[model samples]
Target: MVSKHTLLSNDLFGDLNPKDWPISLADLPPGSALVGGSVRDGLLNKLSQKPDLDFVIPIEAIKFSKNLSKRINATFIKLDKKRDIARLVINGWTLDFARQVGKNLEDDLLRRDFRINAIALKLSKKPEIFDPIGGMDDLKNKKIVAISEKNLIDDPLRILRGFRLMCELDFELEKKTQIFLKNNVDKLSNVAPERIKMEILKIAHSNWNSSVWPTYLELQLLKKWNEDKLPNLELKRKDIFSTKPIAGVFLAKLICLLSDEGLSSLKFSKNEIKRCKNLRFWVRKINNLGLDNFSEDERFQLHVDLEEDLPSLILFLNDKYANVWLKRWEDPSDPLFHPSSPLSGHSLQKALEIRSGPFLGELMRHLSKEKAYRRFFTNHEALEVARKWTLENSPFL
Candidate 1:
């Protein structure tokens, strides 16, 4: 609601400092302007150490991107030829250039998904902030406001992206924007699976809270994709963030929310799908039959199966067991936690004169389990146990 337009250049230039960019802005075209996240971040003064930059130009973006890559010695990639979108990678910074979507910069900015993301800075000797949509006002108020409902409907991935921004910036979604998102949640299926998967992980990696969980549930975001009902657990915990290999935390939380069918529909890798499936299987088993009821062999097999991914399961345990298991999992020398056979498969095969087959595989597993549970400590004992087991159970004999 301002009656007339005003030019505000107070601190934006100093905050952004185009002269400090890895690639000088002097090389860009006359009308080239820095837009999107870089502008939004500059306005917030929360720029990353190496911020990604996006630009909109009046003319050929792909050609300009390639020329810039050659000049700056960057890696060039054409993201979309039809749309005249391209990317340049150099010095840990990524720069994307795209053709203007409409007649002018204001039109292009108006076409963006959110007010916070629509602010643009015209790059020049005397740069000025462009706030055709009162985006700066929205940023000041710390709220997410969609440009229009049609924008969200045009690209439903923006629906999830808005929540990710909400988490990253600790901003509240404007009530109307939330309603627009809720209405368009079903259209998310029309978007590409990889794009959806990428946004899902970005949300997982953000600092989410209980409040955001209910919003996601209300939207029924993952309900259609999952084979079963979503996990009802509140995954917020202190140790989850403190644990090493934090990627496992993200993956574990994702699998808890999604099912194998959901993950497959999103085209997750075979290994990831398998790991999540096995983790779900064991989690169900452990929940059904109490952990206290597991036999020694069953416990040994759990460690064996999840030795690499045990960190992912530790959060599911109670405090006492979680602390104990985490301590053991961190210690490489903890025999039961990090199980290994005292004798190698080769040694067992040679000593027992057994060919490499199912029997030999079974012998190695048995020896490894026996060693894991403190049943044997040395190769001599392993050989003795192997000989006795072969005599008693070997099909070849």
Candidate 2:
């Protein structure tokens, strides 16, 4: 039986219902409670952007997690079996499960990494707010303070996590917390590379205009994390974070700005590394060619290479490069820059008597380049142009 505590109203938490949650009142383990993010976000009025919900139960966390995962038809992933931490993921739903580290809510909250993340509400019909570490007050103050020094020592990942939270919530880290973060920066090296990569990517993908690099630099975390790949703090550009959340191209740009070797150490995916390398290649090519020297075909190829990334790339470059891109596309509807190709593979095959194979693909690329360079206006004209080009280029013709 659950009691309805009006103060801990489920209504305030937009998506935090028993049906939507990992476990319902009937299935909730004894002494299980809704803790951390879900409760904090509800009070903070960040219902929409909250990522995942957290729950703590006294023992049986893994068994309960597996059972709840079965109930919700979610994927049960054991985060730390020894520590009794598990995760359930199903579509948009994510719930983290952990056993209470101490005897009660106070002890659990005290053992948490930060005060702003320690508040909780019991899992009952009659729920009540249980905040023992002044988390509510710290949250209201927009302050991020560690629960205790031992907490940071216990998990060095919290140092990185604290900076991430500061960026996410735009909060100020307490002075003592800052000292502790700086001192234990070395422990971050002991953290799993994948864990470190995830945090870095989160910082990139966030709407936080502020750079975590600054925080990392302050704590020497950046130097420690960099090892040798990002040797120069001045050159390891951190301005890639912006009001615009990091999407594909932006993320690639960030990776390029940060050294390839640094990303390798952090264990970014092969695809991510490849994209970043391509982006760097494009940047170098653009610099070497200059705005005026780049032919229309060359510029078009650059745009195609950087797909869905023109505006961002244009903005990120120096004044000269940015101006060149702006000048190139001043007429947004310019025929030379139009995405539609005037010729098709089938059209070329029929007109040029070319078989549908490697030759056809080559013609398509050729015609597409001509289209960007404004060599032909219509499909018929493009076919004629292709016919001439094939006669000149083909050995047997």
Candidate 3:
């Protein structure tokens, strides 16, 4: 089998000098020889006949191929094509590109959004590191610096991306970058809620949950949203610099803290609002229970109640007391607080031998409640009780 890297080299560089192709392009998959075209042919002739030719020239292809090159060592082979493009595939990365375009890797690196991501490695011609944006310095300093100011302005989503990086990379925002973020926090409002929600979820799921609230506050981004109705939401810049807290727990707490504000300002979808509301409810429930009265069953129930709201629950309950409950609740071996209903409407319908209707639904609910409260050992026992109750109470039965 041809080595994946060798194939990629042939695909990207072919007979061309390795120095000319961008370092990032070294990883693309090999392209098939285009028997018809010449290197001197115009871009239209090369591209018009083969759409893949254009794709090979794009930065996306280089990035994609480079990632592929890392996985497999493919051989590079020269092709006698009219255009300076070649094709090869290695571990799923393939592209056809002009050798000349490959040489100017610096221009390609500059197009990236952040300095950190702009760093690239050349695989061929005495492999070397390329950093057109000084990303290495930023990385060393633990900084989340943008590639260009305009990069953030052109796409407001970068603001959230920056926040995400801060959380993921454990990097601090540069002072100037922070000021720029504060000035443009409003631009986030223009971004789609789905995009914003994705970033928020990522942060909430990360170890940087605590950082998120404070960072948003510093930018006054949280205040700009109609979260004024949430209690204890005082925005203090110092909060961001505080010790990092558990991500999930902080998220739940944040939602509860912002419950009154309604998720509308954040542009959360209906489903997202429901999830947030459930999270808030769980947080409030946990808070109300306090540390003293929490029982194994209660803790289990807390987990069940939270359901998908688990992340939020974790966020809200960060106190020492809450931590105790979390330890118990997080134990998968422990029985769930409230197991799913043992009795269903169908059970009621079958037990009653009655047509499916509201009556069966009502009976099922009553039976479920009894089973929950009484802690029936089995579904059969619950059904027996439901039968007796139905026989005595149902006019139709």
lDDT (0 to 1) per candidate: 0.81, 0.70, 0.53
Worst 10 residues of 1 by lDDT: 1-10
RMSD to true structure for each model, in Å: 3.9, 4.8, 11.9
Clashing pairs in 1: none
Worst 10 residues of 3 by lDDT: 35-44
Off by over 4 Å in 3: 1-112, 192-194, 222-270, 282-305, 318-324, 327-336, 378-381, 388-397
lDDT per residue for candidate 2 within 196-232, as digits (tens), equals 7777776555544334446655766545544333222
TM-score of each: 0.86, 0.80, 0.59
Q: What is the clash count of model 3?
A: 40
For residues 15-84, what per-residue lDDT tens digits would candidate 3 score against the true structure? Answer: 3333433334444433312211122122112222222222224333334434444555543333424434
Better of 2 and 3 by TM-score: 2
Q: Sort by lDDT, best first: what order? A: 1, 2, 3
Weakest 10 consecutive residues of candidate 2 by summed lDDT: 228-237
lDDT of model 1 at residue 166? 83
lDDT of model 2 at position 305: 66
The superposed Cα distance between candidate 1 and the true structure at residue 204, in angstroms, equals 2.8
Q: Which ranges of candidate 2 are over 4 A from the true structure?
A: 1-15, 49-51, 67-74, 90-92, 210-213, 216-249, 256-258, 285-297, 319-340, 355-362
lDDT for 181 in candidate 3 is 77
Candidate number of the best TM-score? 1
Segments of candidate 1 deviating more than 4 angstroms = 1-22, 41-49, 70-75, 90-92, 134-142, 242-245
- lDDT value for candidate 1? 0.81
